[model samples]
Target chain A: MTRPDRAAIIGIGYSDISRNSGTGPGTLIARAARAAILDSGVAKEDIDGVVGVYGSDSPTVWPGYVVDSLGLPNVTWWDTAQPPSIVGLSSAAQAVLAGNCEYAVFYHGKYRWGSTSIASKGDPLRESPAHEMDPTFSNPLVSHAGSLNWAARVMRHHMDRHGSTREDFGKIAINNRTHALTNPRALFRTPIKMGDYLAAPMIDEPMSLLDMDAPVDGAMAVVVTSLERALDGPHTPVVIEAFGSGLPIGSEGNLWPEADGLAARRAVASLFGRTDYSPTDMDLAYPYDGFTILTMLWLEALFTEEGGGPELLRDAWSEDEQVLKLFGRMPMCTSGGNLSEGRATQGFGSVLEAVQQLRGTAGDRQIGGSLNTAVITNGMAATNRSTILSVS
Target chain B: MAHTRRNYDTQPYWEGCDQRELRIARCADCHTWIHFPRGVCPNCWSDDVRHEAVAGDGQVVTFSRPRVPDGAPPMVTALVALDAADGVRVLGRLEGAEPDAIRVGMPVSLDWHEEDGQLVPQFVPSGGAPA
Candidate 1:
């Protein structure tokens, strides 16, 4: 109950598919759990504790059902975390740190996104016979959250508040797409120019279609246990230096923290609080890039980079500016991320990339460095709910 | 592929859909109201929660439009962060909405939409206090 061996992530497991593998939720989660257990080098018998975050599926993928299916002793902890799974990971880490169990596993699973299970109370997103049956449904309508027109509200606020431009948004996508080539996992691997990004499709007013995470489906899982046990048990455990989740827990003045409320920098600062290492001490960080503009905001959030990170990204892709390389310096998501590579769920892909980098098994996309730590981030939809993962 | 009858999690929400009322949980303890009923008050994690009808009276807490996959977008939508118990918010497509009329703090209320045995929460401008 007093901080069990200082949890470290031992084994990372993944389902085979990076793109919508055409799998169902049950199969996807089960497969990822199986792979993680096997990769950890510990027999399933050694596992006494488990924490999980299921999505949207209520009543069906309930923890009791998962516990019964996985054949684990009566579950001590279970939570169906939404799109952003790191929030649940923080909870799981607490349980493990609390000594509820010697070894624990945290998992997030999902099927391809297109098959999203909708409530019958008329799926708000139900397709008309034309869109579904006719292979083309006219975009019925569009609107925004607290921001009025999505990030554009923020963009408006940001631009009106500062003096940025539509070009700033386009640059993030261009740079992210260019970075995709190095990542085998990104969905939009094709390189693009700033002009192409500008000329490309627009989803809502001011928000470009490419500004969104290409919806697909996939699952990702990570194993957590005491450092000693994790290191001694099997695969080299990735040390979990620190992590944090914050819900406007207090700030009531504003409603949605769309871009900044998550306080990711604060989360990362807290994670590294006890450690003497600075942001410069880590290898790379991956902030959730559900939209290109979101990632641009993350540049300042991480504190290790400049706000113009997205612009750096665009220039690196275009022959116009210095390549935004993070070699021995700032290694971001070498894995094609939700933006370019695979866009199913949020935390899974980012978590996998961190594990891959830490394990030195990143293969082709390996960044050159001591590579001891990497930060992965996830944000909930248009909401500012975000969590940070510092994997070492 | 036609999916089967989907189970509605919030019975009151669906019930409200039947009567065209936007229903919410009033934190009996805190006098705060919220949507997506949480058993415990998000403010204090206290479970002293009960139901209260939100005139859908709220502000646009957040809004967005997914115009991808083209044509089949839902009605103009925004998450109305309401003035209910503890000031909880609900996500629904705005009703009787003029594109420019939808303001971030514009006061609004509920309009219900029921289809295929399903009830959904839609919002309309909170009209003059119900006489």
Candidate 2:
């Protein structure tokens, strides 16, 4: 990896977004980029790479075009992927490693609400996985049973094996929203109790609304540069110690009845192999929760620490009787993940949260300790994309 | 389960249902074979590749029989790593997949259907049949 000392996130930026980009894409992208440039503490002239991806019906406004309109320097590279913010990050990493550019800018802003509805119309079966379980395939076409339902099935099996429940699952959302109370950006600021979660509307038989992440119209951007370049920027820089991505191979034979290990484990191993850091090394948890059960499944997949779901719930949510009994540690979703807080136009908000925590700029939602290690699992499909970031 | 019209992308493979034959792609670059789809090999990462028909004589690297059926007529599927190529693998419907008969490294050959314009791929025990 002779890629110029690689890259580290030096600054982060996000736009004030909501259900409707009442303001539209132009306004949202501008705001998100401005936040990124200012946060990076480096001049706007420094960003040479802008990568992004979007799935929408509106007119295509490529990231490079957005970069040009911003009156910033010429972009050496630009790319996009579906809703997974980390996909953009992955592309950015390749661009950095391939020596395509030095300072990079990644952002996405879209009307996430309408995207789902429009998406469902196309090859309805193609997008149906998000809404219902395809019993025809014996796999979920959509819903908790949808998409990566196999991962949840794995979690359910583990829970029964380890003695856990929907209530234990509630600890994750409960603790996340508790953190959201202080985040003005959070759309669902209404502090929730575990009971409140258990009572929420059910999406799948066992997964409830609280378990699934709510969608919002927001865009976030992150600035990355060489380690030497980072120190010269606004704040002390945190490097991306490792980022690993796994392509969906569907090796389980049956997506319905999963046996032994989950497919993403193969991918998780790839990332850990790169940096050799485990879950215990990270002080804060940023498990991707496109759906609630995924958070539980991810905790077990990380294997950076011991214990699975109940233990994870207990570690992050101490006040709850269910979690306390399991003996878990490491705070989860302190900025109120995509669930309690609102999901943004682009998925980059998760990575942006790590920057906030690392820079101690997380405002009222500030996590207690100076976050040294942060693990972010960012993809949503059966495919798992994850990265472990640390203060070097 | 609804006889949901299967997506045409895989009709070639499923069409091989009645007569057993397994379909795969052979690349022009390294004279190696592969499956799924590719103008190139994922292993060699080359675009200089061609699709050549071959007899699906492969060994079962690993397989799982679904107790209950899933997709098409509830049958077992196996990941076949072919002997013809290095590191080339494909998933195919298994025929005569008796619990006792199936074993890792079991020798199998292609038997398939050429339906609706596709060289659909399927598998049967080696020497039992060939397409």
Q: What is the lDDT of residue A116 in candidate 2?
A: 55
TM-scores of all candidate predictions against the true structure: 0.58, 0.51
What DockQ does predicted model 1 obtain?
Answer: 0.18
DockQ of each: 0.18, 0.04
Report the TM-score for the A-chain of model 1.
0.57
Task: Identify the CAPRI category of the predicted complex in candidate 1.
Answer: incorrect
Per-residue lDDT of A1-392 in model 2, one digit per residue for the tens? 34665667877887776643333343355557667867888676666666665554321335533443354543434556666678778887777876555677877665443335664344422222121233122221111111232333444444545576877778777776777777666677787876788788744334556766776777666778898888888786978877664323223322322322353454466567666676667777777766666666566667523236566555546674322212355666666778755656223556777778877888876767557878887643333457777775
| Model 1 lDDT tens row, A25-52 | 4334545665676688876556645556
- Candidate 1 has an lDDT of 0.52
Worst 10 residues of 1 chain A by lDDT: A134-143
